[model samples]
Each structure stands twice: as structure tokens, then as C-alpha cells.
Target: MDNQRSLWAAWAERLRQRFSFILQGQCALCDRPTSQVFCQDCTRRLQACRVQSSVLQIAGLPPLYSWGYYEGALKQSLARLKYGGRPQVAEPLGQWLAQVWLDSGLLERGLVVVPIPLHGDRQQQRGYNQAELIARSFCEVTGMPLRARGLIRTQPTTAQYGLLRLERYQNLSNVFQVGAALQKSPNLKDIVLVDDIFTTGATLKSATETLQQSGFRVVALFTAALSERQIA
Candidate 1:
């Protein structure tokens, strides 16, 4: 029964993907008519923000790969994706991230993509988790397995926008719990966390520690954009 259910779920996902393109209307950034999430001109401008190099060795975090700096078109697109009811925006962004990862020669077997999850209440309010949406498209392009529910946000925290660096860390402490799927298979390792943005790194740090403590090896973090402060 479990195997049958898995097959059904996979079929349903494929069916959804098959028709997802038919729903596209206007570009998320500009209101241009487009079958894609972004228009050609907007996509070109967004690509201009891409970081030439793929990997950045931050002081204490895992190897990070961000598609672009969080500024200009990239920033605006992310804002629309996260706050403006534009879930379709993730499709292209995730594809872009996957392309960069492939081009960087970082492709490897057994690395599971785990999207940073939102708390249940927050996800219910938003109707979707942007990170998970991005990770789904990323896996579609990369063929890497996606553990969409590998981690659960057990506690709801306030928005981290105005908080200081230390405060942000405090906000997310002990917030992530290993989901049941990951708990059932203790051998699953080699996690690559995906998120829409890497800001002060507080959120990723807490999540990485949680996964590490749970015995999973977090190899890298893949994000669509890096905060301007991170670029400096």
C-alpha cells in the first residue's frame, strides 16, 4: 500500500506539472503577458544580477551557492514571490539555481535537497512555502531527490526583518525538528538546504545545527539570492 501510494503521489505531481504552464498569465515582476513567470526582458535583467562564481566560503557556514545578489530585479522578484502572492516566481528562480549548480560541477549522487520549512501556521497563512516550491522545481531540473518534509518548523517565530543578528538567531533556536519521514530513515544523509534568500545567516545556521545534531551531513546551502550585506 505504501509503494502504491508513492506511485500515486508521483503521478499526481507529474499531472500538476503537465498543466502548470497553462496557468501563467502575467510576469510577476512586470505585468507583461508571458507564459512564464517572468518576461524575457525581466529575465534578462534578473540574470544580470547573477554572481559569476558559484561557491562562497562564508566564515562559519557550509559552502553556499546563491544565484544572484539580493538587489535590483532579483530583489524585486523575490519580494513578489514571497509577499505578493506570486508562487509562480519560484519556477524560474529554482531552474536558474539548478543551472548554476550544474555548471559549477557540484553535481553528486545521494545529496538530498531539503527546503527550509515554514511553521504550520505560517504556511497555512501564506498558502505555500516559497522555499519548498523552489526546491521542487530545483529537483525537477537537477534530478536530485527532494525531501520536502525533511524538517518541520515546530515553533512559530516573529519575522526577522528588523531584528539584530543575534536576535535573529535567538528567534529560530530549537525551532526546527526532524520530520517523521527523516526520522523513519536514519541512514539518509548529505542534505543540501534550499531557501529563497540568505540574509544574516541566522536562520540557516540554526537549521544546519538542527540537521547536524540529527546526524545528517549538510553539505551546502543553495539560495536564489544573497542579502546585500552578504555580498560585501
Candidate 2:
């Protein structure tokens, strides 16, 4: 049954790829009528966030790069995909990350991209880790190996959205653990940690510690956006 299901999925994915050329649409981040979801201007804006960090970086974490703030159409798009079950949007968003990385020189310093992982229960519920979806797409384009299976959230703690900054850090301190991605990858050091967004920078920080403890020379925290840092 599993093999049959896999065969069907492969066929479906092939169909989607073959028919993708017939697609036409505007940008997801901006409203301009372009083949991609985001127009060139909007793409420029998101790419700019990569070089504009106030502090440049956190210790031992990769630089965070976002396509845009969690506002306007980007926010709604993320909402639809994250909560409304529109997983297809992930492909374009992933492409955005890949584009930003290449244009911004993020890949010049790092070889591996590891997406933040979800706990098994959450994976069962969502049937995906949104981070992994983006990472998989990113890996395909950048020619960088993606460690999608490593670093898991062992505990399902309360959502960090409601917690204060420090509280958010404390809440996630014990949440993530290094997974099989480490055991299997060759030359695992100097990894670029990828996540969808960085709010308090706690989740990525904790995950970095886990990987470092397991001997990875993590460099920076890279993401699609920065949430708490840009408050007015």
C-alpha cells in the first residue's frame, strides 16, 4: 500500500510539474502581474531585509533573511498556507528564499541548509513541517544539500506567540533536539539554519545549541522574515 501510494504521488507530482508551464499569475508578495507570485519590486524589498539587520547577527547563528515583513499580502499568504491548508504556495515562497540566498551571497558561506523541525505529533497533524517544505525547494535550486530530517521539536509546548520575548525563549529552550539529519550527513559543520520566521530568536537559538552540542559548527539563523525586531 505504501509503495502504491508513493507511485501515485510521484505521478501526481510529475503531472503538476509538466502542467506548471501552462500557469500564469501575479506575485504572492506583491500584486504586479508577473509569472511569479511576487513582482520584481517586491522581490527587491524582501531581498533588502537580508542586509538590513540592526545587529547583523546573533552568536553562532546564521544571518536571518526575510522576503518581507509579516504584513500585507505576505502575511495573508502565509496565513492561508499555514492555517488554510494551501501547501502549494510553499513552492513559490521556497523559490523566493532560494533567490534571496543566491542574490544575497548566503550560500557562499554555508553548505547545508537545515530547516527547523516539528514534533512528531505536529507533523502527523499538519502532514508537513512548513519549514521543511521551503527547505526542500531551496535545496533543489541552490544545489545545497538539505538536512530536512534533523533537529526536531521533542515537546509540544504552548504556542510562543502569546509569550513575552524572554518567555518565548524559555518556552522553546527545551523544545528542539538534534535528529537523524546529523547522523547521516557527511561534513555536517557550518550549517545554515533555516526557519520560516524569527520572532524572539529563541527557537533557532535553542536549536543551534542542540546542534552545537552534537558537534555542528552552526553559523547563522536564516529565515523568511523577522517578526519582533521591526516593531514600531
- Flag regions of model 1 displaced more than 4 Å: 1-24
Clashes of 1: 0
Work out the TM-score per prediction.
0.87, 0.74
Model 2 compared with the native: what TM-score?
Answer: 0.74
Q: How big is the positional error of residue 179 in model 1, measured in Å on the Cα after superposition?
A: 0.7
Q: Please list the C-alpha lDDT of all candidates, in the order they appear.
A: 0.90, 0.71
lDDT over C-alpha atoms for residue 93 of model 1:
91
Highest lDDT against the true fold, candidate: 1
Tens digits of per-residue lDDT for model 2 on 1-232? 9999999999999998666645655565544466765568865664454424322455555566666566555666676566766565677678877777777754564468889988788778887788888788777878887888777788987777779978888888777777777777656677878877777778888898888888887765666666745443
Compared with the true structure, what per-residue lDDT tens digits does model 1 show for residues 1-232?
9999999999999988766755667789998767877889998999899886767888878999999999999999988988999999999999999997898787878788999999999898889999999999999999988889999999999999999998999999999998886887676788999999999998889899999998898999999998878765
